[model samples]
Target: MTVALMWEARAVEGRGEELLAWAKARVLEREPERRETFRAPQDRVLVITWWDAEYDAKLPELPEPGDELVTRTVHRWRFEAA
Candidate 1:
């Protein structure tokens, strides 16, 4: 039974680009089979990442200390084929 890991995060003002870059790189290295990854900043945009058919995955690297790239929230959802 394979699963998908859904990662959604929002960064504080001004730090969006760096965080987004980190997310893109991390997914490539950590979960090469990711189905999707997106980052956009509007009034409060979201960075959405999808890891496809995952059995287990290492934790995504955390932002460095003093980065202040807080995670307003995080979510995980199970995927079921239709």
Candidate 2:
């Protein structure tokens, strides 16, 4: 089964594009089965990465974008394919 990792960040004010670009660049280094990025109205960026591995397996994760770039702390969630 594939493991799906969800990463989310809410950029401060007008930094949504910057945050999106950062995520895209980073995720590209570790190619996954599937990856998708989304932006919301309130500068929220969401990235979903799907991998063929266990949830407990060690995997590269999105790092925090720091308080200067984001309004709230980054969020990460892991799930196994149903």
lDDT of 2 by residue, 1-82 (tens): 7999899999989998998888777844567898898988998999999999877988778889878889988999999988
lDDT (10s digit) by residue, model 1, range 7-31: 5666677777766666655533464
Candidate 2 structure lDDT: 0.87
At residue 2, candidate 2 shows an lDDT of 94
Worst window of 10 by summed lDDT in candidate 2: 22-31
Off by over 4 Å in 2: 27-29
Stretches of candidate 1 off by over 4 Å are 27-32, 43-67
Clashing pairs in 2: none
TM-score of each: 0.54, 0.89
